[model samples]
Target: MTFSAVSPDEIAQPKPELRIGFLLMNHFTLMQVAGLVESLRFAADESFSSRQIFCQWEWMTCDNQPVTASCGLPVSPTAPLDFNQHWDYLVLAGGLLEETRNPPAWLLDAVREIHARNIPIITLCSGAFIVGNAGLLDGKRCAIHFTTRDEFRQRFPKAIPVIDKTYIKDGGIISCPGGTAIDLAADLIRKHCGEMRAEKGLQYLLVDNGKSRSTKKATGEAATLLYDNPAVRKVIDFMRHHLDSPLPLSEVAEFSALTVRQLNQLFIKNTGYTAAVYWRRMRLEHARKLMSDTDSSIHAIATTCGFSDASHLVDWFRKQYGETPGSFRKRRRDVEKLVKP
Candidate 1:
């Protein structure tokens, strides 16, 4: 049998070597730390990385002693910190952020030192606070647990917290709301490698049915965004995936195995709105995206978003944004031009 030689470019790009330094301390969430580690493991699986797995890591603590997580899991560092070599990524993992009064001086010093050396820093969940203490997030986009998002903003006025996102990556400071650490890990894999490996990792972890990093809420704050409840999340996911042909409440209720009354109650309790109201808001958001991103006519956008007509969409648009869709698009485009120029 004859075979052709595969060129260097044709082969999968050599996976980038990764040295993830975990700055562990008391009360770090076990799942958060494990999720990140396991995702990398899955990336190394041939099913994911296409036989090019290149990542190595170790745990490090500030004191070089055994660290116990908030969930009572114990871990020991593989080595002590050495500042000679630059790290690929430095991740700080911990919990009880609101209660952590004073971070050790060494942590601050290490963060500042590594940061000055131009290493990318990442914070998990409440770990963002420590990153904030080091002043790395100043004037950078980041993510924090939604529960502390307001306070994070108040404390670090220069750091932008994306309340609606699962993570934020700006200026080499990657921050993810850690309450959903598994999602955060998946996101990190997607960043360090690519979606193919991330997807395979998710599959290996049995999280393939979960939403993509973009679609998942930052944390349990799904209640504030959509509605707090598993049923609501599922229903909203269904509707979003079928925006052009939304299922009726009856069908949604059936899918969720809940009666109409129960579903309505849950939606109301979580979002202060009924199922009908939530669906309308979802459609409106969809309409907004279509209007801003495409030159489709008002009628076309309205029909696509399940509105009765353009007039119906215009009424809702004006009610929500204080302007007509056309005006909103024009204003948004002007703003985009100004920012780019």
Candidate 2:
């Protein structure tokens, strides 16, 4: 179909003075940091006239020391992390949350100080752990990596955790699951700047490349019975649709037109887990999402995820994660504090 195009004059320009700082720690993910920098650089280049994108930027490392990425590559920062200068936005980009003991008091103070002033902050990947540590996410809605979602939930039951979304902007605090760094930056550019500049920034980054984009199904409902196997897929689809209230193994087997033993064998063969185990895992996944993304009570979460009670959920979670759900959520919340919000 043909469509009308808007003239160049109608496109909005980005304001150039927005300062974006990358808070680098040891063993940071290089790709995520690079993605953020490149997106901003592209935005800056495209909006040079307005100077609204990249005029003010800095890579602030802990103690101004040279940092190493998880991949063993070294990254030298452009500036020392002195919380003095006024920054418009800050990003906590690192993967060393598990080892960040005795964080410099200044860094914590700076985050708290800056966030108290209402500045925006973004955390990528495990950096959410640092942000959570900062205590800024105590009652805010945020996103964490799916791999780390369970840990995050057990740690911070108060912080609302979202599922599946790459990132979330709850007021001034922006949290991304990481890896999808470009999406986070693009959202920032579009929100604080403009959609056109964000588009151009994407183009500058050559982000419309293969494997970087996902093929989205037409609608949520379109995925109701997506697979071709009428019986097995039907049971799978039902489980997917009822993640908040998962069916028992017997019910699943009946729905799939198989006996319990037959269904169990087939599921184990296909997914490397028994039917009950797979269903529990699926329910736990939904529970993890709710735990990380919502303020729901543990009791409610347990029931929603098809557990008999909170204790049952906790027992399974601990067996799987080596920690209680509450502790895990708190740990992630503690990490989120590292980002300046």
Candidate 3:
């Protein structure tokens, strides 16, 4: 995700970098459409002039019919779905909740065909609905927009619906909920196109690249990258998402397909801390963040972070930060007051 400004000679040379096939569903989201494709265009050419030099994206459809957007705008397909046609990633601009159930045969077939070729599928907004109904997301971690989390869970019980992550990838499926599409678009550019091209594209879009890093960490993506073991990563992510009520190590271990002892050993190897210790620190860190960012009382913050009471939180907080929660919150308030006009 690092993209420092390179010297003139170090800039990426023009070449065929990324090829993406965009599948526009009925009643698709137009905002996601503009942000994703426009970012890719900025990365594709010099000075915001799009010539598809470094990246190529096409609007496609299954039956060559015009796909109406949620805003009442009808967009004709650029081409029909051709399984033989190669693409780096097949992206879906998703639609409403009702569209998910009993999807049309043509749409389902297109997804199966595209996946059979081993091309990755990127789902934006509710498009995870399409992929999940198409049977492409079984046992995969799919990022769901907060509004659709419950429905996605009921429909696809095997698929893990992650509301915290901005974007996520599981094997061939990549997903982003809502406007997080911008960050996902940036990630795609940086992965296929060179770093220079990604930076230039964001520069034109005026996107702060630093926000992506913080968002990723806030979404538990930092822990996912710490260990290669999929089970360890899953357990850590579960821990982060449940900071309000930390689950037992045994239950989480079972969720990750590892026993309690096995999970602890992997955690020690990957993160240099046992599961109990790491999870405690994660809860304490969350409490600290709440103290600094919000105006909640100590008892409220303690409850949110899974502590029995304010005193329970303070004991652990002092052990970790060398000060009580009250002191930290006071210092942050004082510093902010001093800086404000």
Candidate 4:
């Protein structure tokens, strides 16, 4: 299928500029900062022209000192912290060693002053801790990386922390788990710029369709089981939870509040697969994950993934991947060894 090209007139002209400020903490994750920045940069201009007509961003530090990322790359700040300019959003780009790095007094003051002016505060990754510490996150729903959920909850009891979400926009405070800053930037661009611009930004970045905050999971597992329909989502969730013991189609249909025929029709209509086929694909996906991440024997892996026996697994694995389980494992190991430094 071919996608329609966006014409010059179809391209949206940047209007009502959105200014964003980034507060980079020491040892911040580069992926988070780059994802947000690059997505916004794509949305700021039409197509690939690198113009800052729509969105403008500034990188700042409390003391105007250079900050090192978690990956050991150092970045110099463009300016010292100042609230003189009107900023649509103030993002706290958090670091890997969040527990050790405390927000200095000046940073906390800046946060409070920005909050007082009704500017939205966005926390990327462990940056939630900084806003939480500044009392900006009190009594607000927030999102944080799953690794930091428990500690964040204990540290800030008043703030409601949600782990099973990519991002949350509660009033003026927007919180996002790390590595999903691209989605957050796309959402902002969609709201401010236009859907076309957001689509262009994601296309330029080579990101697939964006995901909503509700579809995310705490373990950072892809929410592939989630479907747009509630009934379909319920069935998918049931199938995923019971992957260790395969459930019959009749029972799966009942859980989805649909008859077997209705379930089949729904599955085919939405996902182009019958319920049984979809369940089999999910099981195969689980088996592939086990094969790649664990050292389980074929028999053990088969049973754990709801296969009847080793032969049954081998038959299906070969049919799906064009290789037996043993051969696939060996090939994967060889590739890993060759790529290792």
Task: Name the top lDDT candidate.
Answer: 3
Give per-model CA RMSD.
Answer: 15.7, 17.5, 16.0, 18.4
Candidates' lDDT values, in order? 0.67, 0.64, 0.73, 0.71
Query: The CA-based lDDT of model 2 is what?
Result: 0.64
Between candidates 2 and 4, the one scoring higher on TM-score is: 4
Shift in Å, residue 20, candidate 1: 0.9
Question: What is the lDDT, from 0 to 100, of the residue 84 in candidate 1?
Answer: 55
In model 2, the number of clashes is: 42
Clashes of each: 2, 42, 0, 0
Model 2 over residues 1-341: C-alpha lDDT tens digits? 11122234532332233567788788877777777766666665344342322334677787787778887887777777777666778888757666443356677677777677656677777766666667777766677777777878877777777766666655356777766477666655554444555677676666773423331121112222122234545666778777666556787777788899998776644334576876787787667657666789989999888888999999998875467889756744543342213
Cα shift from native, residue 338, model 1 (Å)? 52
- What tens digits encode model 3's per-residue C-alpha lDDT throughout 99-179? 555678877888888777667788888888888888887766788888888888998998878887767776467788887
lDDT of 4 by residue, 130-227 (tens): 88888876666788778887788888999877877667765357778777487778777765555666677778888765343232232123333223
Q: What is the Cα-based lDDT of residue 261 in candidate 1?
A: 93
Candidate no. 4 TM-score: 0.57
Model 3 residue pairs with clashes: none
